[model samples]
Target: MVAMVASSLFASLDKDGDGKVSASELRGCMAAALGEDMSEEEAAAILAAADADGDGLLDRDEFLSLAREAECAADEGGRYECLREAFGMYANAADGEEQCITPASLKEMLSRLLGTSQHLGMEECRAMICRFDLNGDGVLSFDEFRVMMHDGLM
Candidate 1:
């Protein structure tokens, strides 16, 4: 069951049906799977996180590693719970704007989404900010946020 689930997850991430996952492909997969838009920078960060070998791409093995982590975390309760938490954080950050997620807001949002008070220290958030801050203004516009989140899916 685990292998099947892992395989499915990997296959999904391997967009374009290619045997290998390039940096761009992985970014697309993350956005699709996470249901968020992604900016070019955000796409890069997601790719970097999944590309364990640092080969600028994600292989099946690397994807499985990430899937396993997500699976384990989800098993604690449910994947939807985690996703819901993330959505709530993002929604709050939106603050009535069409595009609510900014780099600073994403930091706070991810911290809550990942359920970490401080130990993890918002590594994911920082990574996202680093990747998506297009104007070098240290923030992401709604469109940028959407792109980063929804790269491959849409």
Candidate 2:
């Protein structure tokens, strides 16, 4: 059952029905499927997450590769649940009724969750923030942070 759901989800994510997902297509599909409003920065962060080959696009294989990685990290059910819980936590920590989690907040959350320091001078974190900060705001909302973390873990 989980596999079936996962397969369906992957197919839906493969927008354009071309068996491959371009960056724009993936972003649109994710936004639509997740029922989340995303900023340009958020979309870019998602793209970077799924584009494992650094080709700026995601083919079916790449998508599957990400799924496999996630599956390995946690079974499908566990991963899905973790994501749901994380989303809830983020929503609760949002700045206002808008329920938006900023990039700075995301960093803090990740650092805490990962047992890192408040001041992360790691190159990985720097690169992640740079790659996902679409508006040059130097901050990523919950939506953006989720996408970035999804990609990184995968």
Candidate 3:
């Protein structure tokens, strides 16, 4: 099923009737699919992370990776894994060595989640940290992130 979905998505993204998906095509497809444009940084990061063959374009096998990831995100356990992946991604992206999300990164993450670079204010991010930061360390650990993501689950 995921294979079929990936094939269909690949077909749609392969603009200009090409058999591969370039980074630009992927950026446009992401914007159309999400109803918000992805920043160049985001698109580039995605391409770098997912481009398996080092070809600078996504072929069938490469696109299947995203399809599989999306399939995982659709399930409950996979949702937890997805959250963990997101936390790890940000934690590793940060300059600090604590393996946690800094407040500034958290603010940017919130803004991204809100679908705009400036949709979320620093104050709002601070308030959110106050609400979820159990250790009061001014940064979000994976536990804190899980709590925030699963606020309604409990």
Q: Give the range of the ten consecutive residues with the poorest summed lDDT in model 2.
A: 110-119
Clashing residue pairs found in predicted model 2: 49-151, 101-142, 103-140
Question: Which candidate, 1 or 2, has the higher lDDT?
Answer: 2
Candidate 1 TM-score, true structure as reference? 0.43
List RMSD in Å for every model shown. Answer: 15.3, 16.7, 10.2
Residue-level lDDT tens digits of model 1 in 1-154: 5556567656655656676667676555445435675677866777688887787777777777877776676653575465455444564334555544554566654443333333234556566666865666555655555555445222
Better of 1 and 3 by TM-score: 3
Better lDDT candidate (1, 3): 3
| Candidate with maximal lDDT | 3
Candidate 2: C-alpha lDDT: 0.59
In TM-score terms, which candidate is top?
3
Q: TM-score ranking from best to worst?
A: 3, 1, 2
Cα lDDT listed for each candidate: 0.58, 0.59, 0.70
Question: 27-116 in candidate 3: lDDT tens per residue?
Answer: 876665445788878777777787888887778788888778776657787777888886875553435566777767776554443334
Estimate the lDDT of model 3.
Answer: 0.70
Residue pairs whose backbone atoms clash in candidate 3: none
- Per-residue lDDT of 31 in model 3: 68
Among all windows of ten consecutive residues in candidate 1, which has the lowest summed lDDT?
Answer: 111-120
